[model samples]
Target chain A: MLPNRSRTSVLVFLLPPLLLYCAAVLFPILQSLFLSFFSWNGISDMEFVGLDNYVRMLTADDIFWRSFFNALLYLAICLVLQLGGALVVASLLTSLRRGRELIKTLYLLPAVISTVAIAFLFVRIYSIDPVGLLNQLLHWIGLGTFERAWLSDVNTVLAAVSAPEAGGSPGCTCSSSTPR
Target chain B: MKKLFRAAAVAAAAALALSACGGVGAASDPANVSPTGEIKPREISWLLSRPADGAVINIMKKLADDYAKDHPGFALNLITTPDRPSYIQKLETLAAANKLPELFDTDATPFAQQLAKQGKMVDAEKLLKSLDVYDDYRPGALDYQRFDDGSLYMIPFQFELEFIWYNKALLEKAGVTVPKSLDDLPAMCTALRSAGITPIAIDGQDQWPLERYVAYQPFRAAGPEFVQKLKKGEATFTDPAGQKTVKWMAELGKAKCFQDGFSAQGYSDAQNQFTSGQAAMYNIGTWELPSLATDKLNSEVRDDIDFFTLPTTDGSVTSANEFVSPSGIGMAVNSKTYDPLVSDFLKFALAKYPAEYAATGALSPTTTVQTTVPANATPLYKKALETADTLGAKQAMPWDTQLDPTTNGRLQQELVLLVQGNITPEQFTSTMDNTIKQNAPKFFK
Candidate 1:
């Protein structure tokens, strides 16, 4: 509903940022897509292979497929633990009458922590040789039989790694979802 | 509106033009040797993977400082990244951009061979020959840095021998004798486990330590040639040598040789386990001698520590003396950055390096130098140094360095699963053979 002159001024003001977005974001995506047609070892000359790279990745490479499935699994777990857990916590926080700020701060603590520190912390917790916290707790409860190396066991390793990713950011989501 | 559309199009075109210019700017000339250039006394950078406080870095820093005293404008810039995986990623990225510093550390892996082929790395053998210090290097140390074609492009700086360090008291308590052969290891593990002792402490978190275990059986069965051929796809994991190795690893797993959850353990954790007498054996290198063979070790386990050489196997092609003795990761000079000053500084540094490094109770790569064992060092330290002199010609080339990166990664993962009993030896062999067959040609050729 702006007048013609004002509308032109607004468009002029937005032009620089729009151009930057195209250059920074769109260009890299387009370049990567273009590079997908070639096989180059960064230093070597790029050789155009048409669709050979895509075909091999989809059909021949077992590791690629395995990693693809792992990514999907990670996404599913992250959705459940991050969004679902955040919703639950948000609902509980909205109901609380007092100490809600304190509880929220506690929940948000991990979100503020660096991922590397969190990863190291979890590694220690999952460790078995030095009797980590999880194992020690299990032993205290006489559930030592259930205690195993969470990070190393092939069965648990995927879920073990996923858990830290899921747990680290749930508080941010919770804070967003909570009623103001 | 029409004028606005035209203006937007012009802006977009200008942005594209700028991006193209940026791309052109990124395309650098290929690294080349400038043999006739004058010596420039400026700062030179060395990107290293060793610990900042490690003996190698400490000695190098001293040498650099001393060299700086003579050359007024010279400064040695040390960029250290202690973590291996991250360092490799950074190194490879810098290499791709043709921005590798004046000096950098690298193992003699296939990737390094590619760099050498590209003429990015200086020929270390030729450099040493020109410097008149070629013969001073230990043969084993020099051999470790040579490519399959016997081309040397990396300089060795440190020598280390991997050993099975054990607690004598724990072995006595378990009533297990020191293993004399590779096959005897499992039985020894069983005896130790039967006495409620953890048999071995391994830093499986790093994955390379477990990969080292994979190399031992093959080296004993077929000597170093098996891996050499296997890496090039001329041999395979299903071959007799590879089969023996896989089976032995599985047997070690069955015997509960390593501590429970060993793969989850870090280097320090594994070291602590052995030093605190919680584990009976630790397979580590001589780099650990400062702590393991010195009074710096825990007092309770200090007197009980001893090490044995990698044991031989039945029908072993390799001798007892031939094992995993590596001259650490080698340092490569950037051919693009090489000049007379760099060469002069190297000559000065290399001359002083061996004696200084040896004086710190660490093994230098030079044969002319001997490690001055600390006063607090145990007899075991002296014994290990003597054994280094009698080492055989053949060395157990680490598989992690020999195999292509992709196959090497897969092997490391599969090795963990194999030792964890998640995969059978047959499955491991088949998968690895198929992996090698697929990837070797791309890397080797």
Candidate 2:
């Protein structure tokens, strides 16, 4: 073991990091926990509801559960599209060494693009009109019969947005009415 | 010598931090109140959500600039965000950080009501009265701002209404007559589809349009009980009108009158479909007119575009068909702000809002001057206006207006399930009922 001087110095060196952790992460989380007790709107004095908000969220708020489960579903989809694809890609790149730099740049291109642009592009592609690129691709691939509104139809919205076929980020947000 | 230099450096750093905070505190200090109760040269901020070319923002800027030039004692600094989706999040962030601007845009969404209940917004009735031109505003526009006890909360902006827009050229070519009642919709939709044209291109991708069916249509078709019941808690959303609305929604989905992937298309996408001449009729609000009127739109499509008042159920009591909301977005002053000059700016803004709105190609909630009625405006806008007198006279809580965030979220998802054909209207209503049961018991009582 080091002398007592070494132990004291180590403790002193760790102090700043510990304080930063408590101030940033720990405090906010704890504050949220306490705030959840109240029925108060964010402004006025918070009234203590004693776990009522939690109870209501689970038992009565179907929207809350829908949002919750939908998020989980999305998370699962993301894992498959992102993690699974990345692994396959990394392995392929490792095994096939030629032209790897060009391929890597192409693959990463979409991930670097702005989200709003991606959303706008996909919107055009998924439009029901036959002129949409996705419909054109469907026609070219002999899947024209399956060409339908990729975004607007409630039936295909979730899965249509799943892979997005672009990059790691998925496009399956709640329908526009749900609000950001 | 090195240790002494290090100690001196640490002391200087500590002192600099203190001075920086002290400087900010001093700068933030309120200017002395003027003897005449006028504002003492100070910057008051207004946060709003309006797109870059939006007519309302242009009017607001002009009025603010004009006021600043004349008043000299006050300056109104306006901050705006382009989209509504991010408006609330940004506002909440500002509020939490104590960076709340003096005047900010707000809406009648339950979230806005939450902010008003928290006392963040100024009493708008009081503000209007202070201007001495309160009577100049079209009556009934302020109804949405009122709380459960009838205290006003938000001041509405768009003060707009929704209606149906059809392509006259397409209708004339197809030989399908304009539908005058809800019953006529079936034949209209069926005939249009049979002729190889999509009937009504709805933006079901966004759930708000679904409100056109669930909340607005029932009242339009059957009567106003749809809104009254929700307001009084005497009627549950599970009623026949509500169910009828949902059934119609499902039937429309099954009929394939909407585009193939409608659930994904947003407002703009649906608009584009009609504008491109790919669709027969588009369902939207008055706010869409500015974009629709642009020269970039398909010439044939633009000329053929015409509006129609929402038709009633042909013979139902209270089937009067204008759907108006004072709950969209409006500029709200912070309660903490107090200045006579700020009042002067507001006076100028409200007084010119009607005229400025017309200049910007916007319709106003205030009836007299809000609209000169676009010379080319479809007859529907004026027809819809004849029914505007009934606004706020008898109503119920709009679908998402009264619910807490959690419940509203459930409707957003489950409502999509209904549209997808995975669920029924009954299921959707039950899910919503369950949401209220689980979340808002007090309101139910």
Candidate 3:
């Protein structure tokens, strides 16, 4: 129902941003998809390999499958912690009368902190030689026998790396889910 | 509406087609220099991958400043990326776009070989020869920078010998003598562990440190030829040399040689473990001599620090003197930037570098230049430099710089699993062989 002049103005305003988006995002994705059909070392001349790269990735590359499964596990963990935990936290926050602001601020702290700093913090927490916080806590609680290098153990490394990512920003979800 | 949709689809298709046709422009022809051309002073850049505080960078900075004082309007810009992995990514990306700086650090890997093949790098041999300093370099140092076909394209600056630094007090307390042969290592580890000492500290987080262990046994068992052939898919991991290496790695794991959770430990963490008297032994190169052979270390452990050369194997083809003695990463000059000014600056720098580098109680890559032991340096430091003179003909080339990137990465991962007892030696061999078979042809050809 808008006048033709207004519609033209809106289109004109949107055109620059749309072009920029295509150049920055869409172009790279399409380029990668196109380049995937060739064998290239970046510097050398690329050889056309058709679907060889895909075939190799799907069948011959064991690391690919390992990474694929690890990604799935990461997704599941994030869903449980972010979605399910956020619902529970949101409910608890709604009932709070005092210090609600402080709780929310504290929960949002990790989201504001740089990822490098957070990674360093988690590394210290998982360190084994000098005894990290996790191991120290286990020892103090009379569970010293269970104390192991969390980050180095294959059984626990996935969970160890995943915990920070999934649990770090549950506050964002919690805040969104909570009613004003 | 249908017309608009059709237009959009066609535009998208056209964009994709245009992008597919787009290619990186070829590098310009190399700069030509007249014999008597004026050496104009200008800014030059070096993309580096060394520690900012390390002896190499310190000496280079001083030299650059001294040169700048004489050449008005001259500036030497050093772009340093201390972290290895990040530096490699940056280097490769720049190289792909043919935007490499005046000079850049590189390993003599297949990738560097490709660069040389494309005439992107200046011929270092010719440059050095023209400057009359070619004969001054140590043969081993120069050899380390040569391609598989013995083509020299990069210049070496630092020479180092890797050694197993041990704590004398810890060895005496554990009642274990220094291992005389490669096979004696596992037993020595067990004896140290029995006496409540962590046997060896390793920086497994970086993976290359553990990869060094994988190279040692093969070097001792079959000499350097094994890796040279193995990297090209001419030899399999099932070969005797490879079998020895894999089994030795497994044995080291079984004996509990490295500290618990060593795979997660970083460079600084492992160094701290040894320096604090928690670990009995550490394997590192002479580049660490400043901390290891000086009072800079913890006073309690400083006096106890001593080192031994790599041990020999029974009936070993390689000599005891032949081990992991590397000249560090080499610097390649961009052919496109090889002007008269760059040539003049290099001639001045290369002449002054050796004497200045040696004065810091570190080994230099030139045979003609001798290190002047620093006043504060311990006797151990002098002893290490003297040992470098009697080094053998063969050296254990680090596998990290030898194999293609894909195979090398898989090997590093598989090595961790092998040493962790997660995978048997047989499984390790099979997996590695398959990886080399698949990836080696792409690089080697």
Q: Looking at candidate 3, what is the lDDT of residue A38?
A: 92
Q: For residue B1, what is the lDDT in candidate 2?
A: 36
lDDT of 1: 0.88
User: TM-scores across all candidates?
Assistant: 0.93, 0.79, 0.95
User: What DockQ score does model 3 reach against the true complex?
Assistant: 0.57
Fnat per model, in the order shown: 0.46, 0.46, 0.46
Query: Which lDDT tens digits does candidate 2 get at residues B283-386?
Result: 77667665564455577776787777566665555433445444356666666564666665666677777767755556565665645556655544455544
lDDT of 1 by residue, B1-445 (tens): 6776687567666655553333111322223322556667899999999988998898888889998888889999999999988998899878876788999999999999988887788888888988899999999999999999999989998999999999999999999889988899989999999998999999988999989999998898888998999999998888888888899999999999998888878899899999999999999999999899888999999889999989998899999999999998999998877887888889999999999999999888998887899999988899999989999999998888898888999999899889999999999998999899988888887
Per-model DockQ:
0.45, 0.26, 0.57
lDDT of 3 at A103: 89
Which lDDT tens digits does candidate 1 get at residues A32-60?
77668877655555668999999999999
lDDT by residue (B143-233, candidate 3, tens digit) is 8889878888889989999999999999999999899998999999999999999999999999999999888888888888889999999
2 or 3, greater by lDDT: 3
The number of clashing residue pairs in model 3 is 0
